[model samples]
Target: MSSLEIVKQYYTSFNQKNWNGMLALLHPEVRHEANQGDVRIGTGKFTEFLQKMDESYEETLTDMVFFTEPADSRVAVEFVVNGIYKKGEEGLPEAYGQTYVLPAAAFLELKEGKISRVTTYYNLPLWIELVSKPRND
Candidate 1:
């Protein structure tokens, strides 16, 4: 598959909450750079991160726009995260099923048809403000 197709599948698996599918597309020694967090390597570490995220949030990506380098193995995706703060995370605000919409972006590098690196970014302050407000319903 082409780099663009692989990246698309990655996000599709994410939206479907298919953890295994997502993992299948990743390189064994995948490098992950979490938004505002430390760098982590390997699928095992990625799985741990996914588990933690699954525990604290339920999110879907919307308004996705992808850009690829014609002669490189890089792909960049811009999207908005529509999410619910299902559970409270450490060092963050309490969660009361609060909802949030935040703009986010991810940069991915593909190697041998698998994702080898992923770096994600998002507005932490905006997310904090949105989730800080308790849901009315």
Candidate 2:
């Protein structure tokens, strides 16, 4: 499949919370960077990250637009996240199922038929502010 097709399926799998589906697109030694975290290598590390995220937050992406270069090796996606903080997380604000909307982006490097590297960007402080708001909970 094309890099763009892989990326589109990646987000579709993500929105479905399909851990296996998301992982299916990764190269065995895939490298990943989440938000501003240090780079992590391998599909195992990526799996752990996804598990942690699932435990703390529930989110869906909306208004997604993708960009690909002529070389067909890289793809970038821009989207907005509609999410709820389901539990308090370390080094972050209180959760209590706080609702938030935030913009995020990701860049992917495709190798062979799988994703070799994945990097994502988002405004952490803005997300904190949104979830920090006094919730009726």
Best by lDDT: 1
Off by over 4 Å in 2: none
| Candidate 1 global lDDT | 0.94
Question: Model 2, range 5-94, lDDT digits (tens) per residue?
Answer: 999999999999999999999999999988876889999999988988999999999999999999999999999999989988778998
> Every model's Cα RMSD, please?
1.2, 0.9
Query: What overall lDDT, based on C-alpha atoms, would model 2 receive against the true structure?
Result: 0.93
TM per prediction: 0.96, 0.96
Instruction: Write candidate 1's Cα lDDT for 1-137 as tens digits.
Output: 89999999999999999999999999999999999778999999999999999999999999999999986699999999999998998889999988889999999999988999999999999899998875577
Candidate 2 lowest-lDDT run of ten: 128-137
Model 1 / residue 126 / CA error / Å: 0.7
So what's the TM-score on candidate 2? 0.96
TM-score of 1: 0.96
Query: Quick one: how many clashes does candidate 2 have?
Result: 0
Q: What is the lDDT of residue 65 in candidate 2?
A: 98
